[model samples]
Every structure is written in C-alpha cells, then in structure tokens.
Target: MALLFEYLPLILFFVVYKAVDIFWATGVLIIAAIVQLVYYKVSTGKIETRHWIFAGIAVVLGGMTLAFHDEQFIQWKVSIIYALLGLSILFGKLLFKTNLVEKALMGLFSSVQKEQEVEINIPNAIFNQLLVLWVFLFLSIAVLNLYVAFNYSLDTWVNFKVFGLMGITFIAIVFTMFKVYKFLPEEQ
Candidate 1:
C-alpha cells in the first residue's frame, strides 16, 4: 500500500498522456493530492498548519499558471515552493525558536515511547535548523526537476519525477544519518 502511494504520481503520469501539456497530467495528480488532503482532514479531524500552507501555495502558484497561460511559470512553481519552504525553515529555526518541520513531523515520532520524555528537552533551535536543511533539500529537488523539464524533454522530467527526487532525498537521508551516527553524545 505504501509502495502504491509512493509510485502513484509517476504511474499516473505514464498511464495517462505522460505529463504532456494541454492535458497537464501533473495537475490531475495535484488535484488528487488535494482531495486526499481533504479526506484526511475529515477522517483525522486535525489539519496540520504546514499542509494548509502547502495548499495555499498550490492554489496561488497553480492559479498563476492558469491566469498567465505560461507553462514555464507552472513549471517553476514547485521550485518556488521548495525554495520558500527551505528559506522559511532556515529563518524559523535559526533566528526564531520555531520549527515547522518538527511540528509537521509529529506523527512520525508520535508512537515512540521516548518522544514525550524528550519532546520538551529537544532544542527548538536545532529543530528549526534541521527544518531549514530539509527544506533546502526539497528546494534542490525542485530546481533539478525544472532543469530536466525545460532543458531536456518531458520524458526526462518524467524519469526524474520517478528517480531524481528520490536520489536527492536519499542524499539528504544519508547525510543526516552520517551526521547523527558520527556525533553521538557523551553520556555524563
């Protein structure tokens, strides 16, 4: 089931007209994502702030794409969102004591027994810094995607859509894992 969810976007693009314009198959995937978000809210009875912000971005940027009738604008939308998210994470964590990523990521660690014990002790600043890093990682993905979509071909974009994002994400994961592993705290 998780595998299905993961590959669903790439599968849709290929099963349809293959991310081609006029059809704007990516738009359909976005729409489906929106619907899933709505259903999640109904079922869970909680709406995360980050998801709301993401929806706002999608609407505004997607509307911009429609209003201007420019594919480039639309193509660039994901990058803008990624860059903005990255910047926000950087600022929120480094300058302020906020952590959008930590807050948005509650579900992942919610089940851990030590989560509650360590939650309060965790440095908000570091979480914010981590958010910044994660967001920048996402931004890298957006930029790479744009490069392939424009300079190469839709097929290349589709291929990246399948593998490129994962590759970049894997890089982040490995970096973080190595950092954590190498920097084990000295127990007092």
Candidate 2:
C-alpha cells in the first residue's frame, strides 16, 4: 500500500506524459504528490519525513516547470530527491548516531519475526555496512538520473526515469533481500 503510494506520482506522470505532454504530466505529478501526501496524513494521521521531502520537491520543481514552461526543472527533481535521501541517511548516521536503514529495516524485520515466533539479530557492523551500501546506492541513483537527463532527449529521459530507474531500483531491492536472507534464522 505504502509502496504503491510512493510510486503513485511517478506512475501518473508516466501515464500523463504518454497521453499528452511534459507540461501536462508535470501538472498531474504535482497533483498526484499532493493527493498522496494528503492520503498519507489522513490514513496514518501524520506525514513521514520522506513524504514531506517528496511533496516539496514535486511542488517546487513541478511548479517551476509549469510556470516557466520548461521541463528541465522537473527533470532535476528526481536527482535532487535521490541526493537528499542519501544525504539524510548520511547525516542521520553521522550526527544522530542513528542508522535510518537499520532503523526502518529492523522495524519490519521485528514484525515479521514476531509473526513467525523467530528471532534474529543483525550486528551493528552489518547494519553499518548496510547503511553505507544504501548511502552509496542513493548517490549512484542520483548520478545516473542526472547523466540520463543531460545526455538524452526529454522523451528518452522520461522513459529512463520511469522504466529504467525502476528496473534498477527493483534489482537493488532484490539484491538487498538476498543479502538480508542470509541473516534470517532457519525454520526448525
């Protein structure tokens, strides 16, 4: 549900882009982001930090795209959001002594374990490694987005943004799941 919500705007953007033009897609994306944010607030009773970050980028950058009738600002939105995610994880680890990846993963892990009546603990060293891996991944995604945006046509970049980027991310998550499986307790 949350995952669907997270990608709702991008999915809508792709649909609108294919149906109409970049300007219309940008406008729809902005609206989708706002609707997603509002849905989150109503459903969860509060907005997550990432939600705010995404919505802010969408509105500001998409607004610029709409106002100026240039698509470049909206094109930069993905790279900026990815960089911000990487930086926020880095800052949280360095300044707050909190590993956001570990924090989020552990919460999900604990819930699953509770349901299965199993327990598995990941060492801090491994969590640190995971955090570093995520930071690098985020930064790499940002760089990749920028490279595609600059070197390719808008239509090509939009395709890369929706399909190519999603393929990379899906592969990344699958790889991470394999790594995580190593630490799971075997069922008796």
Candidate 3:
C-alpha cells in the first residue's frame, strides 16, 4: 500500500499519457505529485525529504513542459531526479560518513521484524556494499534515461520511464535480498 502510494503519480502519468497526450499527462503528473505530498503531510504529520524533493522537481519541470509546450523538459525530469538521488547517496557516504541506503533498508526491515517477532541481522559491511550498488544503479538509470529520451520516441521513452526503470529497481531489490539471505535465521 505504501509502495503503491509512492508510485501513484507515475502510475497516473502513464495512464493519462496513454489516454491523451504528453501535455495532459505532464499536468496530471504535477498535480498528482502535489496531491501525494499533501496526503503524506496530512496523514503522517511530516513529509519525508525525498517526497519534498521529488514533488519540487515534478512541479518545476512539469510546469516548464506545460508552459513552454515542449516535452524535453518533462523528459529530463527523470534523469535529473535519479542523478540527484545518486549524488546524494554518494556524498552522504563519502563526506558525511552516513549511509542513507543503510538507514532506509534497516528502518524498513526493523518494522517488519517488530511485527513478525523475527530478528534479521544484516551486517554493516553488507549494507556498505549495498549502498555502493545502489549508487551505481541510480547513476546508471540516470544515464539510461537520457539515452532513451534522446534516441527513442516520446511514447517509447514514457514506457521506459514507467516500466523499464521500475523493472530495473525491482531486479536490484531482488539481488539485494539474495545477498542478505544468509543472515536470516533458519526456520525449524
């Protein structure tokens, strides 16, 4: 449910794009992003930093696309978002000695562990490796987005944005799970 909420804007954008066109879809994307932020604020009492950053990018780039009557601005949004995310992770680890990826993953699993009465202990070394993998993954996706946006049709780029990126992220998650499986306690 939370995962779906995170993706609501992208899902709506793809649907609206298929029904109408890029302009209408971009408008929908911007509105949906704002609505998602509002919903998070109202429900959680505090919106996450990533949500704020993503919504800001959506509004700025999506507004440019609508105002200028050019899809290039909207197309560039994906790459920009991914690039910033990758850089944040890289800098957070290198300069600040903080691992954002480790924090996020541990927070997620910790919640599940509390609910299921299970202890999942993934080593800090594994998380450090995972963080590096995630940084590379995000940067690669950013580069891939630019390549597809420039070399492919708008429809193709939209499909790649909605599906290809999601697929790649899913694969990465699966790979991470495999890497961490050895740490899980065996069931009797």
Candidate 4:
C-alpha cells in the first residue's frame, strides 16, 4: 500500500501517456505528485525528505516540459531523480557517517520484528554491503535510463520507464531479500 502510493505518480504518468501524449501525461504527473505530497502531509503529519525532493523535481521538470513544449525535460527527470538518490546515499555515508540505506532497512525490519516477536540481527558488515549494493543499483538505473531515453524512441522510452525499470527494481528487491534471508531466525 505504501509502496504503491510512492509509485502512484509514475503509474499515472504512464497511463496518461498511453491514453493521450507526453504533455498531457506530464501535467498529470505533476498534479499527481502534488496530490501525493498533500496526501502524505495530511495523513502522516510530516512528509519524508525524499518525497519532497521527488515532488520538487517532478514539478520543475514537468513544468519545463509543459512550458517549452519539449518532452526531453520530462525524460530527464527519471535519471535526475535516481542520480540524486544515489548521490545522497553515498554522501550520507561519506560526509555524515550515516548509512541511510541501513537506517531505512533496519527501521522496516524493526517494525516486522516487533509485530512477529522475532529477532533479526543483521551484521554491520552486511548493512555496509547492502548500502554499496543499493548505491550501485540506483546509479546503474540512472545510467540505464539515460541510455534508453537517448537511444530509443519516446514510445520505447515510456514503455521502458514504466515496465523495464520497474522489472529491474523488482528483481533487485528479490535479490536483496535473498541476501538478507540468512539473518532470519529458524522457524520453531
């Protein structure tokens, strides 16, 4: 549910693009992003930094796409978002001595542990490896988006954005889960 909420704008953009065109789709994407932010703020009382960053980029890039009547800006948004995310992860570790990936993953696991009365102890070394894995994953996806956007047609790019990138992300999640599975306690 929360995951689906995060992808709502992208999903809407893809659907709108398929039904109409890039410009219309871009407008819907912008509106959807704003709506998402508002919804999150209203529901959670505070929106996450990442959500703000994503919404800001969407509005700026989507606005440019609409203002200039060019689809290139919208196409660039995906790569920009991923690049920023990857950089944030890298810098958080290097400058702040904080591992954002580990924090997020641990927060998630903590909630599950509380609910199921299970203790999952993942080592710091494992978290470090996962952090590197995610940074590379995001950077690779950013590069892949740029490659597909420039080398392919708009239609192809849209399809890749909606389906191909999602497929890659899904695979990465599965891979991460497998990597962490050894840390889980054995069933009684």
Candidate 5:
C-alpha cells in the first residue's frame, strides 16, 4: 500500500532496531528518504520543500548518531521531528499568510457536507492542535521507550511500538471523527 512507503522509516526502525544496529536503521531511513525525493521529483515533476528539509535534517542527525557512537542520538530523532512539525504549523498560522496544514492536506481536513464553506480558522485551529498532539505523543513515546528499554527486553518495546502507537492513533482518529460529525452542518 502507499502508506507502506509513507511510513517506511518507522517500519524499518522497528524491525531493524531489534535485528540490526541503530546505525543501520538510520542509514535505511536516510536512503529511503533520498529514493523518495528523486521518485517524487521525477513522477510529480515538483519537489516538496518540506520533505527535502525533513530528509536533510534526518540525514544530519543520523550522521551525528553514527559519528558520536550514541544510540540516544537516534532516539532524539522523533522528538526533534515532532517539535519541528509543531513549530511549522504554528508558524503557518502566526507568520505566514496561509494555513500550511490546510494547504498541504487540501481537502482531507474538510467534511463531506461542508463543500459549501470552510472557515479557515477551524482548519487552522485543528491543525495547530494536531501538531501539539504530535509533540506530546512523540515525547511520550520517547520516554516510554527509555523506561521500557531500561527495564525490559527490546522485544517488549517493539511490541509496544506497533500495537500501542496504533491503538492510540486509532483512538485519536475516532475522537476526531466524533468531533467532526458533531460539528457538521445539518442536512437541509
């Protein structure tokens, strides 16, 4: 599925974190991002600046992790990415004239019935909140990983990574849907 590639870094990280070293996982993430960049450029004929920035940061941070020989560096990767994304969304709302998340997600944030009208503030608020949520989620995951890694086997962490994150995400999706449905315009 298309989502496979979209989340390939995560998949590679989870699998390789157990089987291989963190350095190998970092390499795979960098390589995948590189391949994706060229693929998107060639196929879509336009490069997303955001992706390029993210890939570049990952490469630099990954290289640091390998160079300094510290696994903690690799773990900070998600935290930094989450913070950056949260800041970006905030930036879009406060500084930029456009809503970055809304522009990027296009119609994904809008309801089926509201083809009639979308209040810009609503999308902006939702996206800003989502960004903040990501920050908290990533930080919590990082802390949980630390606690689990120190206390138990890596296998437990891996299992938690897959099932726990997925469960939380599913719950968030359901909550968002409930909110959207509640706010949808009534049928005429």
Candidate 6:
C-alpha cells in the first residue's frame, strides 16, 4: 500500500537498529527515505509536499546523526517534521483561507459525485473543525516525541518512536474519523 511505502524508511530503521546499531540504522534510514521518495515519485508521477518534507528531514537530521555520531539529531527529526506539518495546516487555513482537509477530500468527493449524480460540498464548519483537529494532533505529537526523547534512554526512546507513536497516531485517526463522519456529504 501507499501508506506502507511512505513508512518504509521508518520501518527499515527500526529493523536495522534491532539487527545492527544506531549508526548503521541511521545510514539505512537515510538511504531508505531517498529510495522511497524516488519510487513514490516514479509510481505516482507526482511528489507530495509531505514527501519532500520527510525526505528533507531524514537526510538533514539523519545525516547529522551519522556524521556527528549524535543520536539527538535523529531523535529530533520526528518532532521537527510534526511541527512543520502542524504549521503547514495552520498556515494554509489562516493565511490562504484554504482548508487542506477539504482540498484532500475533493478527489473522493468527485468520485462520489459521479456515482450519485449529484454535487457535494463540504461545509466550512467541517473544514474549520478538521483543521483545528489536525493542528492539535501535529503539535501534540511533536511535544510527545520530545518528552519521550528527553526523558527516556536511547532504547526506550527508539521504542517510543517506532511503536508508541504509531499507536497514538492510530488512535488519533480513529478519533478523527468519528468526529468527521457526521460531516460527510450525503448522497441526494
């Protein structure tokens, strides 16, 4: 799946860390991210903003970890990426009056509209609510990552990054689904 492809780098990093060492894992992660990005662009014929951001963080911070032999750089990558994501959502909504959630959903809506033979428009309320939810989600994840990184040992932080964070994100997705379900445009 596309989601799995997006996470290939992280998954590989976790595996490599278990098999070898953080230094080796960091190198693997950097290579994996670059490969993922190339494959994604080739397959999709388009590169998403998030893809660029992910690759950038992986290269810059992961490179630092590799070059300087400091695990801190790698630890900060998630927080930085999350912060940027949160800011992008807020920036889009506030400055451009753009609802990224709505924009993202337009493709699905188009398919539904074609099937139902009706027009569908997501209300502004839904957009605003989703935007706020996403901003909170991103910022919260960033803070949580930092909290774990600062407070825990390297092993513990790596565990948190790989498993704990994914669990939390899964929960957030479920919660967001429940919140947004009511706002879905119905077929007329």
Give the clashing pairs for model 1. 93-128
User: For candidate 3, what is the TM-score?
Assistant: 0.94
Tens-digit lDDT string for candidate 4 (26-84): 99999999999999999999999888999999999999999999999999998998889
Residue 163, candidate 6: alpha-carbon lDDT: 97
TM-scores of the candidates are 0.66, 0.93, 0.94, 0.94, 0.68, 0.89
Which segments of model 4 are wrong by more than 4 Å? 116-118
Residue 121, candidate 3: Cα error in Å is: 3.1
lDDT tens string, model 2, 1-188? 76787899999999999999999999999999899888988888999888898899999999999999999899999899989989999999999999998888888788779878887777788788878888998899899898989999999999999999888878877876777888887765
Expressed as tens digits, the lDDT of each residue in 1-188 for candidate 6 is 87787788989999999999888999999999889778877888888878888888989999999889999999999999989988988999889988877787667567877887766655788768878888998899999999999998888988999999899889977876676566556645
Flag regions of model 1 displaced more than 4 Å: 1-14, 17-22, 63-69, 99-107, 114-136, 181-188
| lDDT of candidate 3 over 1-188, digit per residue (tens) | 99898999999999999999999999999999999999999998999998999999999999999999999999999999999989999999999999998888778678667777888888899999999999999999999999999999999999999999999999999999898888865653
Residue 113, candidate 3: alpha-carbon lDDT: 79
Pairs that collide in candidate 2 are none
- How do the residues 1-188 of candidate 5 rate in per-residue lDDT, one tens digit apiece? 76776677667777777688667877877787788788778889987886787678778878787899765565555556655666666666677755654455446645643665744344456755665565456556556656765577546655665667677768866765564454555554
Off by over 4 Å in 2: none
Top of the candidates by TM-score: 4
Q: Write the per-residue lDDT of candidate 1 for residues 1-188, one digit (tens) a residue.
A: 75575446446645553536523654654575576568558878886676676556656655666667655554665677677777777777668866767665454444542534443234555555567679768777677767877998756765676677667777877775453442333332
Stretches of candidate 5 above 4 Å error? 97-106, 109-166, 183-188
Model 4 Cα displacement at 145 (Å)?
Answer: 0.8
Number of clashing residue pairs, candidate 3: 0
Q: What is the Å distance of residue 135 in model 6 from its true position? A: 0.5
Winning model by lDDT:
3
Q: Order of all candidates by TM-score, from best down to worst?
A: 4, 3, 2, 6, 5, 1
